[model samples]
Target: MSVPVPYHATAQRPEWSSLPARLRAEVSTRMGAPVIQARTAGAGFTRGFAALLRTADGQSAFVKAAPHAEQPHLVDWYAREAAILTRLPAGLPAPRPRWTLWEAGWYVLCLDPVDGHTPRLPWDQAELTATLTAFADVAEALAEPPVELTALGLPRLADLARDDLLWWGEVAAGREQVPPLPAPARGRLADLVTLESRLPRYAAAATGLTHGDLRVDNVLVDTAGSVWFCDWPWLCHGPAWFDLVTLLITGYATGLDVDSLFAAQPAAASAPDDALDVTLAALAGYHLTAATSAPPTASTNLPAHQRWTGEQAIRWLSHRRGWL
Candidate 1:
């Protein structure tokens, strides 16, 4: 059989923003403006599409889309994101949301874009550290009990978990013509999967809110030094360490040893091994999904993301293998 496509194989392109005209019309009707076109803008992952809209007046607004597959009925992801933004403390860095809607099995959210640069590999540790703490503050304040993601008409963490195991996990395990990972790494992953199987028992203890996906790529820092997190499709309340650990591992894989950087945040650094396991599993699940969806060939743009992902997979395996 041919090699499987990697998760989010399709790059965010110009047309990913092609919402049904009716949706566009609805946008125009709701916003009371004639939208000329919703131009594809910026890179996004794990959702329908994202773009920027140019109104008849030449004003621009960033747009993110969630198709039916992402949300079955209510558009909870979109609603939760809006709620998070609205609840955000004044003066914190994030995009200014203009509107959000659930229409025709699609959830659309529009916000004002902040001009900024996407940080490359080896992220600036000092900048990232401060930004992370700030983000954590916001996330912590926004933390709440788990909401039925599907009640808002979107897939929940449970849905993504099932899809990951059945689809992405199987695909990763089935790669035939791929370069072999080091034996140590291979042995490591086997152990991780075994350990992860016992997570349900510990999961009940990790109650609260989390950003779900808090990696660096999901963040955008503008030229004026403002940071914006674009995608909110996977927002949820769970383990407190979930967001921090995700950021740390992503930071580590990208050559920034976040643990060293955050050596000052002793409280955060003191997270136990068991919590790390859960965080690693969540991160691993994302990597496996990406590996399943991605083609064998690598891309320059996502090197950090891919490298970090690969490294995290090994870390998970090692922990599972009792190496940790």
Candidate 2:
């Protein structure tokens, strides 16, 4: 089996000293004291500058900054994340946004500090259970989303899937080349296309709010064994089970009993019997198609990650379908 990809160490962040002097000054001023120490974080996929900043008086905060002039898109994502975090219900195990600043052509967001580490690989049942427990509460709270949040005019997942998630259809239409696959899966391309094409309709029937992006790198396990989620820009209206499947990809890679895990989660309670299979097929097509493109200059490991994720999705689907 391929090793679990190192999700945490893929991000490339700049040192505190390397930030523009004016930006550092503004951040320190906002912190209420002169900055004393900074520790760069290794998690996340963006090239944004994220670090734990300490003040001379012992106060600390996690700060993320992106060069707006250089990468306007990343900066926009961070700004949207700040907006989403502030609107979420209190006490959701997500870091609360403290403030935001713009200086020296950079956009910065500061959040409440969470004393935790990214969940390690070769997944442990205990950690996996903790993560799921945390998400169960999140699912319950978001099951009927608040009117205020819905008012944000968040794009529906079903809508986004129409544009970004229908890679198998593209392949079948000859718009994109078919990616290499195992013999079993290769022979069943038509079935794969059918399964993947159902996601938009399946997701359209749900009303719950989903994290939209829940992977190992987006979660943290605290010292007390409580799990906390991070990153909020991708929040959308979709089936809760969707995030469950995305998060469990790491569990599957570690050889965990993911089928049982999926069966037990409250998030999956409303899922249709074939939801998991449809999701796996859709993901397999998306990742496999994405893996063939040139790696982004920002994250070199992304293609590798896509390839492995696609492979895992296919393997997981094949096992459940008895395609062997």
Candidate 3:
């Protein structure tokens, strides 16, 4: 098989000019200066508008908007992100929300822009270390969900896995098919299915705010080597180890010694062995299932990315279970 590519193909985002005139005027008025220039951001899979804006006075802010007509779900996501960011504890290593607006069928959000770069693929060890260290801090800060946040009706990890982590079941029922697997995995499909079915039980009792989508693209490392996590729409309450395990799956694909890394992480170290296995199975099933489908309209390369990560997850699990 060919080596799978690591990145997804992002759609061209909407430009500033595409926004309604009144909305642009409102953004300028709020910035206290006329808009000087706007450049759309290249990261992320959402087919909405995302850009870096500069005001006449040279102030800079990150802005994202989505028209309800084209992407109603994304509009909801931006609104959800704004709500979550506003409630995050002060001084956390995340961008602060500046403003949010809804006007003329568009949902807009402004945020403080970070001077940082997304981590390189097949991660540099030093950067990976910094990311893991920063994640520990993030976990500690969100150890207890604020009463206000719990009321947002965020989906629990257990509940999410029930629906999302069932690719093998789909295959077993002939609803989906996966590419050929190695001898070890081929024989263990039944075991994989059994393991995945236990996801909810293992995911239960996990408590904390999790960056539900933790990946290299979603993280930014500043010059000072601090990690700033972005894309908060998927924020949910779950075990602190959830995010770490998510990172580890990608890290393993990138050639990191994930076992060593997991041993060093305090949050991960506290998780029961069975819980860890269940999380891995769920993630493997999710990515593998997603990989078998056609790419979504918003991203042409997402299937390849998922396939690569799913392969890594399978390899990682094989090692842990001493599979052929």
Candidate 4:
């Protein structure tokens, strides 16, 4: 039996212990700490549960558990995240890897706790500017030597769905009765899909690892207002614009000045600067799908899938019309 170490006040039990003995052990070992208590962290498709554990020596760590839910190659996806972390460029705000463990046929990720407080966002222009500057710098660093998404055990965007309708449609399937998808919104999605298909060719020419999901919620801002990216489960190798698009969409949704934010980066200056447009289209589809696919959890604010979808489409169209 492993000797029990002193539990830190900051440390708590994992939410999985009530689940099963195997999961408890798995969570403990991966975190390099003993499981004292655990619980649901929030409501997200990929993130189901999280916990705070304390090493016998009093270090607190975080353990996130994402179970496979009909997602193809879920195990491989988890492995890919670990791989991406291993190769993160110097000076970016990504979390440091602690350990990756497999237990009870589940992947358990233990990562060092980032030292920061969650910031009040949609950030002001200053904060958004700083974050984008950092993002552009990282993009440039990765432009030269791109890491393959699959090589790191992650799936490419192509693997995410068989077709645009099948991919985004399924996520919104259950929401047809509530705030039904407007016909114009549906048409817009189809149009975006047509444009997105051309992305592979464009992506091939540009370079770098994409964070895939750059929502402000995934960023940690300390008292000093410095930010760090936390989740890497969706890391991918793709066009530089992909990440910029993700960041811009997040800023736009959260009510920030995305243009000035992105302009701070020299690399982004020459890029198409259509990040916000693309991102709005993608997220409108994504959130609609998520609301349809997952069981209702408290964190999700999507009342009707199509409502979000239409609103997002309008935002995208308005941007295209230069209203933004």
Report the lDDT tens digits of candidate 3 across residue range 256-320: 78887887888876677766666676777788777777444365656766777677777788778
Q: Per-residue error at 321 for model 3, in Å?
A: 2.0
Q: Which residue runs of candidate 2 sit more than 4 Å off their true CA positions?
A: 2-5, 294-297
- Scored by lDDT, model 3 comes in at 0.78
Scored against the true structure, residue 79 in model 2 reaches a CA lDDT of 94
User: At residue 89, what lDDT does model 1 achieve?
Assistant: 46
Query: Whole-model Cα lDDT per candidate?
Result: 0.54, 0.88, 0.78, 0.53
State how far residue 195 of model 4 sits from its true place (Å). Answer: 4.5
Note the clash tally of each candidate. Answer: 14, 0, 0, 8
Stretches of candidate 4 exceeding 4 Å from the true structure: 1-17, 25-40, 66-74, 124-126, 146-198, 273-279, 295-310, 322-324
Cα lDDT tens digits, model 4, 8-41, are 1112223565545787766666555675644343
Tell me the tens digit of each residue's lDDT in model 2 across 89-167. Answer: 8789999999998898999999998878888787767888899999999988988998878888888989978889889
* Residue pairs with backbone overlap in model 2: none
Candidate 1 lDDT for residue 73:
34
Model 1 vs truth, CA RMSD: 6.5
Ranking by lDDT: 2, 3, 1, 4
lDDT of 2 at 324: 89
Candidate 1 lDDT for residue 86: 56
TM-score of 4: 0.70
Model 2 TM-score, all chains together: 0.96
Model 2 RMSD, rounded to 1 decimal: 1.4
